[model samples]
Target: MTAPVAFPVVTISDDLALATACARWRTCPAIALDTEFERVRTFWPKLALIQLCDGEYVALIDPLTISNWTPFAELLRDPNVVKVMHAAGEDLEAFLGGCGEVPAPLFDTQTALALIGKGVSLGYGAAVQLYFGITLAKDMARTDWLMRPLSDDQLRYAVADVTYLLPIWQDCAQALQQRQLADWHREDSEFAARRLQQQEPAEFLYRKLKAAFVLRGQQLAVARELCAWRETEARNHNIPRGHLLKDESLLLVAQKMPRNWPALSVLETLHPRALRVHGQAILNAVERGLNCPQAQWPAPVRRLLDVPNGKAAQDAMVAAVAAFASTRGIPAELVFSRRVLENLLLAIVDGQPYPPPMWQGWRRAAVQSALASELTSFGIALPDWW
Candidate 1:
């Protein structure tokens, strides 16, 4: 094991200190960034701490003390400086919640690694070990960042996140350039940053449920209303959705369209406490759904298996995509995950337009060229623009 290097750690609890750091950060071409937050029980992550490194300086900014996040948020939005992070999905969410803005012109080291064929979804610690042969301790990973008076171990863990990130990003950036994958990495990293910051509309939330396809017409409308209500309540209470009402219970209520308290009370999956408290609200949601116009009801969702030849076509397309990615030394999922491909397949089968973003830029050529023969065999033709 390599001896640990000591980087200066400065804590910024006040606005001036943070502003000073931001001034320095503005001059840098790129900076490593990471966040520590508590999200186990809450719908929104409680921002606890922010860490940053720019090859020379390391700073731990206490989010609890800083009232003004403008400086930091501006730095994140700066077009000149690239914000670097590893596996930045959750961190992007944290930034949106904590700083009111996500980093633009982002460089995600994990995505870069996948582009360079290092590994898919390699974690921060593993990447540190891979690039620098330093095995980081995991003891402080689960420490409470919201607590005042953080322990030395906790501080070390937070600092270490950004400490090694800049170097890993440099290596990945170099490798991406060598492989002519810089454009691909940039597209993916920016997409990831934008994607995570988006909030899924509550009315459309039921579409995300796996069992939603089983319901149709009015039942689907009821499910959508219940889902939207649950989403709103969860956010208002700042509690996890399942903590209030489990999905199964919601689905059952939608399916039953229970009218009276006794009817709603019969669902075994519905918790006793929830029934006692939100029973009327749930019933009201059901009433609203039932009164909804038939034209406004959500269209029935068909199971993939219900579609003729859907299974075989999905399987063949998956194999073709995998084979195409392998030949180019790219992670297949990076192009399109199995779940995404399934959705795309379903959309096509329904005569809907292909998702515009997925078929743009480098991905368009990759997918079209890769699946040309397979698509032809299936009697499917991609749009000429693709």
Candidate 2:
């Protein structure tokens, strides 16, 4: 029987010690990294601790004490080193926000497990159970990571995050390599990193506001402008957008197209606090949106289900894709999701290029050519992004 791998943990609260540590570890081919942050009642994540391990050594760096991170930032940006983490979305965000760097060449264990038929979404503790048959210590789900002088238990919990990550990644990566499924992980990891690092315009955020889905033309325009305004205000003040203006009230204001404060005061659902705090700004945004040129407005979303007898069309396409995937001995969803399919269909309808998330790396090589051929049956062609 093989002995299990274990690592020793060390803490570095001083900035100079962490810089030297990161410099020492830069030559490593791979490192397991994790972060502890607090996001309650704030727009930006408050980074508290960063834990890193290179198979043999683990270091817990105190974010509060480390002001100079030039060396650490360089380590994060280095392409030769792979940073392994489980569900690294928020961790990436914290690194971007706190350290002013985006770590790359990532090996996300959660994505690896999902690609290899483990599960769709696995938490850190759950992943530890699946990979090592070792149930993790009790959930530190509600730890106040921002508190100074973290308790011994808290320190242990933070250190434990990176302890198993390196081994789990090694095991998973070996399996992926043997099965020639490494591309799936590479594609997924790239997609995650791109999403976390991309700095899209604030106006683009309007698309995520569900209430805007019901809007069109000038209403959509107003909602978009207000959304941008909210984002800018929240970022400047380091506050949540909802603290500036709730989405429901924001959409309501757009719908009402209130000309002034007198008109805005009548919204039954809008809290008086919001009206008092951001009323003029909201009015100004509405004015700007209403005056915006037609060319500036975003194209309306075309629902595939809205077309007459469209359900049959959707079903036929899904069945055809599923059959194609089955013939190749791969899961249909793994090849292409229904959402991506619909986005392609709508883009074709509007003559706009569709942005396919899985259009690169091994996914593109394995699936794109065949998937494009399949879509042509429905008189839609694949965009180059695929």
Candidate 3:
């Protein structure tokens, strides 16, 4: 096995230097891009290092040194160049949030690897090791990117990340195409891009609310109000949304219907600022929920898992999916797996197929027949109403 290539680190110190580097990098048909940022203690990821490679050269743009991102923004907006990344969700978010733009014609190596049925989401290091026979040191995985004068080892690690990404993507892409899995990757990439475009702080409120099923419409209204309040507070304070108010805390507040400051303060999870700044608003929401008529209450949102005889069907589906996945040498999670299986069974009980199109692909066919048979055993056939 050949030793891994050492990436030449170019630290840009001035806007002119950045523009010059970007211009030079843009000449390549495709560039592998990656970003290192600190997101642990802040709402916005502190972009510390930006890595870019054009097969011939790799450059690391130090955000701490270069303040203006006009050059980098142009690179992202350029449709001609394909920006490649691996497991790039947070990195893409950080870039778009910082520059108000996302890279077009983007390719994600991790997604490509998954489409080929190469064990569900392969880590970059693992993918590299499997395909290229190179071991990457992960000592810098937790390094503080916000720190200046980054050590030589850290710089080497950062550069190595993008240096091999292009080759790895090339190999994975060819394999996917040969196996007729290219379209799946393409569809998934478009879906990811759409998701990145749709990211909004306000929309985060409705995610993963266990009480959403039992809550009346007016209670939902109160929850929405509280969630919105928390989102705004977090953004204003430049802290995590959970730091302002956790989902559990918001649900508790909405459920308890505290009518006054003392009562609101009694909720252990309530942030002090939430009680101080929006205490009156919280009380008003609770009162509105309390006074809401039964007919005006929001209808109970039905969960797929809540259907009659759903658990048994779900378990059978899980087993069938696992068996299929094992036969195909892919991870069970790549097929229907646990979460997707439960979701599919729920969908089936809700008058849909065992596995919806969202879970469709090459590997899916292996399990679909077994899943269909299992659903049949439960008196639930494909495309039949519950």
Judging by TM-score against the true structure, name the best candidate: 1
**Residue 183 local lDDT, model 2:** 73
Query: Where does candidate 3 have its weakest 10-residue lDDT segment?
Result: 349-358
Where does the lowest 10-residue lDDT sum fall in candidate 2?
350-359
Top lDDT model: 1
lDDT tens digits, residue span 1-386, model 2: 12246667788988789888888888899999999998877887878899999877788889898889888999998999999999998888889889988788889998777667676667888888776677767757478998878988888788788888877888889878886778767878878878766655776667667655677888888988999999888877878888888888888888888978889888765578778878889999999889989988777655776554445546665776687667655567766677766655655554555454445566556555555665666566555544
- lDDT by candidate, in order shown: 0.82, 0.78, 0.73
Pick out the ten consecutive residues of candidate 1 with the lowest summed lDDT.
348-357
Question: lDDT for model 3, on a 0 to 1 scale?
Answer: 0.73
- Deviating ranges (above 4 Å) for candidate 1: 1-4, 233-237, 268-277, 350-361, 369-376, 379-386
Number of backbone collisions per candidate: 0, 0, 2
Put the candidates in lDDT order, highest first: 1, 2, 3
* Model 3 TM-score, 2 decimals: 0.81
Question: TM-score of model 1 relative to the true fold?
Answer: 0.89
- Return the lDDT, model 2, position 53: 91
Kindly list the per-residue Cα lDDT of model 3 for residues 94-154, writing each as its tens digit: 8876766777778899988776777567898998888778889999989888887888899
Writing each residue's lDDT as its tens digit, candidate 1 over 1-386 gives 24236678888999999998899999999999999999988887888999998887689999999999999999999999999999888888888877889898899998898888878889888888887888899988788889999998899889989988877777788889999999888888777776676556677777777788878889988998899888899878887888777888888888999988888887767778878888898999999899999998887666788777777777877887898788888988888777777776665554443353465567767777656666557776555443
CA shift of 308, model 2, Å: 3.5
